[model samples]
Target: MSIERIEKRQGATLVAPALLWTLVFFVLPFLAMALMSLSHLEGRSVVSGPDLRNYAKIFTEPSLLKGIAVSLEITALVTVISVALAWPLAWIIATRIPVRWRRLALLLAVLPFWTSYVVRSYSWALVLGEKGVVMNALVGLGMLSEPVQIMATRSATVIGFVHFFVMLLTLTIYSNLIQLSPNYARAAEDLGASRWQVIRLVILPLTLPGVVTGAFLTFVLCIGDYITPQILGGNNELTLPQLIMLQLGRRGDYPMASALSLVLMLIVTLAYLACARWLKMERV
Candidate 1:
């Protein structure tokens, strides 16, 4: 064989294992789920067919439709809040903090990630409870006549999501910020731009890639999350993941659960496409 042909063959050989693994783990399972989604439960046994009834029911059923809406709303809110809070904190760490303390700051920012996800969700549930520390402090200081309801509500879910995602977003935005040339900000200021103007016009534009990447990740994670909403929101409403669980566990309807999962996957795919388009535009 020719030398070039040998090199190509070696490259393919190196990638073969990963390709095989993906086929076995992801592709095969996804195909099975897709097939399941097209079948239906007859009493307790699943019957095989390319039925569209599950998809139709998802759209027509009020509770299922509401689950989709709730998932979208919560994901959007969490993404926005995480980006908003993380950006400034990232900027501070990358620009304001001294080099000596930067590592510690970053560590502290990601401290929550070390804890178990389920534990963190339950902790937040307690913290947002009526007699929790947050409410007790507010009531002690007379901020309210009594503790208000935050736990067992949508607000609690949003708070829990925001707390976790902010750490993730901070890491992305901080990496982006630290890579930027200090000269860019200096030049903008020398040209009579204020600090806010410099950040708005120069720094913000350059960091769009990291911000969007992080936001997209946050959207995917938050949308598919079951633990936080389940514990913190106290079953006040159902998100898509919760609905999928109900179908699988309570109803024993794997077909409906698979259909809902596919719908969630479709939404995440759409979001990825949107982010790709915006990033391409930004590059142009």
Candidate 2:
């Protein structure tokens, strides 16, 4: 009857659509998958289960456990490399580049984004192959005695992931860096801080939120990606996504795939929580 009650009702009405969408699309499917994960395959037939056998197998089986480790290693390596490369690039664009050309510089930096993801991955596959341009150049320049096995390895996967994620990290870091006033650096210099010290102590500390956000995104995407690792890293080492695909495509083991999917989601959730907490602590 009153204006306050009317406003509350209007707010609830506005929120309802989004809540419904999430429930229908995300929540319902997740619940179904969770239920399926509890069940498992019995020699090409699915057996209903409240059993933990699949998850137990995931932990106990060496190959399955190795997939988790491989995913973590590659994701971590890509995140670290991306952040390291992106920060300096974002800094140069935000600080050193003229205002008129900053947009153009950013445009050039993210040009790879215009290409399809599968195309980029495959393109890298060609570039990293033993007889690829890189190896040919290296050998021609006498840098290597022969072409090496970079194509079907973890290095290739990391290179692909870092190439993609560096652009994303640059954008996030640049947004943060541009918002920072020049006065912060000037103030530190006025206090007799060196350029390196100003950046390490002041600029880097302030950009923690953006760095963590970018790193978290990189971790989630890299760990879950199947294309690059399958094409570049090969079947020599299975990442979690590769393992999930194997379960689905080969074994038709829906339960095992569901369980692996849940595990991947859990890892992403944990990363989100850690980043969220770190950002909260930074604010405090």
Candidate 3:
């Protein structure tokens, strides 16, 4: 009845919708999936259970285990490569480009986001094909004696992921870079530091928050992505998401799929924790 109590009630009322939405949509469904993961498929029938067979199989079975490895490898490679490429690109745009053209440059950098994700993956498949542009150019330039196979391989998946994530990473790094004071760099230069030393020691270290944030996003997205790896990388290797789809589509194994999904979530959670810890350390 008091003003403070009334204001507290109003705050709760304002926050209720989002809290309810999360509880209903995310929490309930996650609980259902976790419960379903404990069940197992028995002779083509899902036996309701609170068992650990599916999780056991995931870690024990070599083929199933390989999917997790492949996903991790591809995700790590994509994150590292994107960060490597994006930093320089973001630096150039943030520092070198004219101030008037900066907005246009950012717009151009994110152009790939406008295209459909599936279409972009398929387009990469075409580009990496035997008779595709890359192959033709390489063959014409005598870079290779023949057109090599790139499509339907892990390399193709990494390439497709890197292409999209580079732009994403660029945006994050650029945002951080633009916020930095020019005086920081000028002070470092006045100390007789070389350009490379200024960047390597001063600028790069300051952007750790942005780099880690972008890399964490890249890891989550690249690991869980089904369409890109399916279309571009094919079944030569399977990521966790691709394997989850296979269980549902081909084998009708909901329990196993649910289990795999939990494993994926677990991996993402660990990544998030690691990032958080490091960021806290940075702040300290």
Candidate 4:
């Protein structure tokens, strides 16, 4: 056999395990779900048919449509807020902090990750409640005459998501910032650029990839999260994940649940495509 043939065989051997794993874990389950989505639950049993009823109902029903909108709204808000708050803190840690303490700073930045996600969500529920620490502090400080409604609202949901995803965004942005050479900023300043101009024109453009990556991650995680919204929003509104759970647990409608899961996957896939397109354009 030729040397090239031997090398090809070796390469295939290395790739075969990963391909098999993906086939078993992701592809097979997705195919099953796709098949399940086309069937309908009739009375107590699922009626197998390649039908569009689930898709039709998803688009036509007001409650289902509202769930999609709510999920998107919460995810968008979390992504934007996480990126905005994280970028400055990331920049500060990367650029302003001493090199020796930068590790400690980053560690402190991600301190919340040490706790359980469910625990954190429930903690926020209590903290944002009317009789919670935040409202009591506001009243005590004379900032509010009464405890305003915060818990069981969209605001609480956003706050909970932002708190968690901010750490993730900070790490991504900080990694990108630190990878950049300081000479870029120095050169911009020497060419008569102000500090803000250097940041706005040079630093921001270079860091766009990191910001987009982190935002995309935040979008996926926040949109799919059921615990935070279920706990913080207090069932005041439905999100896609909550709706999916309702279908599975209450209605026992596996077909509808599968369809809703596919919808969620489609949204994440579209987001990833958009990010990939933007990054390609930036490179060009």
Candidate 5:
């Protein structure tokens, strides 16, 4: 074979495994879930018959719709908070921090991801639990007469998500920020613009692609997250993922669970597309 043919063959060989893995793990399961969403639960078994009953039930059931709304609200709130918090931190780390410290900061940002998701979530439970560290500190400071109930509230869920995802957002946006030339801001400053004006006019606009990317990722992950909401948000908060888990596990309603999963997937896909379109426009 010619050199070009051999290179092409090698490239295809390398891609084949990933393609196969995606098909087997993601695509196949998604297709199955789509089929299952159109099915009906007949006792313990999921009856494989084409039906819109599951979709209809999802809309008709107020609780399910409420769960979806809650999920979206939480996703939006967490995305906003995570991105807002991440931007300044990422900017500082990327532009202001010393070269030697940058690596350490990046490592610290990603270190939390090395721990188990459940363990990290339960750590939040400890920090925010009644008689937990935060509560004890607040009580000591006379912020409250009793330990605040942060463990099982919507606020707790949002906080936990922020804690869990802020690192990811920081790293993503920081990577983008690091690539940006400081000259843009410097030039803006040389033109008699103040620091705030430079950032508002130049830096923020340039970093928007990163901001959008981080927000989109954080939103998707937070929306799909079951553990954080389940652990941190007891009976008070019911996200769509938690509801789907309940249907699948507690209620043994596979069809309903599948339907809910499909709905969540659609919402996530739409959000991703919208983010992609926005990014494209920003790039243009």
Candidate 6:
């Protein structure tokens, strides 16, 4: 074989496993779920059929619609807050921190991610619950007259999300930050630009790719999360993932649940495409 043919063969060999895995795991399961969503629930069992009832049910069900809205709201709020918080921290880590401490800082950013998701969510419950640490401390210091119920609130859900997922956002942005040369900002300063101007004109624009990536990941993960909302959210804070879980686990409505899952997947997929398009535009 010629050198080009050998290289082509090696490349194909490396890609084959990944392609097989995707087909077996992701593609096959997704196809199954799509077919399952079209099934009809008959008595106690779901029967295979061509039905638009599942999709219609999702649209007409008030509770499910509310749940989706709540999930999207939480995801959007968390994405904005997490990205804003990550930007400054990433800048410090990438530009200001000593080389020796950079690794340690990165580790610190990822430390929360090392903890179990359940444990982290429960820990937030402990801190934010009525008569919990925060409430007790506030009462002790006469900051409040009564124990404030922080858990089972929308705010608490967002807080828990930030606590656990902020590190991921920071690390994502930081990776891009480190790749950016400091000379742009330095040159801006040398040209008698203010700090804000340097950031707006040079740093912020350069870091937009990372910001978009981190926000997209955070939004997708947060919106799909069942554990955090289930643990922290009260009746009013119902989320889409929780609703899906309720349908599958509590109601045993597999067809409806599969339909809901597909809807969620479609939304995330659209957002992913939008992010990809934005990234491509930025590259251009």
For candidate 4, write residues 1-284 as lDDT tens digits. 99999999999999999999999999999999999999999998999989989999999999999999999988998888889999999999999999999999999999989999999999898899999999999999999999999999999999999999989999999999999999999999999999999999999999998898888889989999999999998788999999999999997999999999999999999999999999899889
- Judged by TM-score, which candidate is best? 3
Please list the residue runs of candidate 4 whose C-alpha ends up more than 4 Å from where it truly belongs after superposition.
Answer: 1-17
**Tens digit per residue, CA lDDT, model 3, 1-284:** 99999999999999999999999999999999999999999989999998999999999999899999999988999999999999999999999999999999999999989999989998898899999999999999999999999999999999999999999999999999999999989999999999999999999999989999999999998888999999999888888999999999997999999999999999999999999999999999
Model 3 whole-model lDDT (C-alpha atoms): 0.95
Give all TM-scores, in the order shown: 0.96, 0.95, 0.96, 0.95, 0.91, 0.91
Query: Which residue runs of candidate 1 sit more than 4 Å off their true CA positions?
Result: 1-13
Root-mean-square deviation of candidate 5 = 2.4
Full-model lDDT, candidate 5: 0.88
- Among residues 3 or more apart in sequence or in different chains, the pairs in candidate 4 whose N, CA or C atoms overlap within 3 Å are none
Q: State how far residue 173 of model 5 sits from its true place (Å).
A: 1.5
lDDT value for candidate 1? Answer: 0.95
lDDT of 2 at 60: 98
For residue 225, model 2's alpha carbon misses the true position, in angstroms, by 1.1
Residue 239 error for model 3, in Å?
0.6
How far off is residue 189 in model 2, in Å? Answer: 1.3
- Alpha carbon lDDT of each predicted model: 0.95, 0.95, 0.95, 0.94, 0.88, 0.87
Total clashes in model 4, counting residue pairs 3 or more apart in sequence or in different chains: 0
Write candidate 6's Cα lDDT for 180-213 as tens digits.
Answer: 8878889999999999999888989998988898
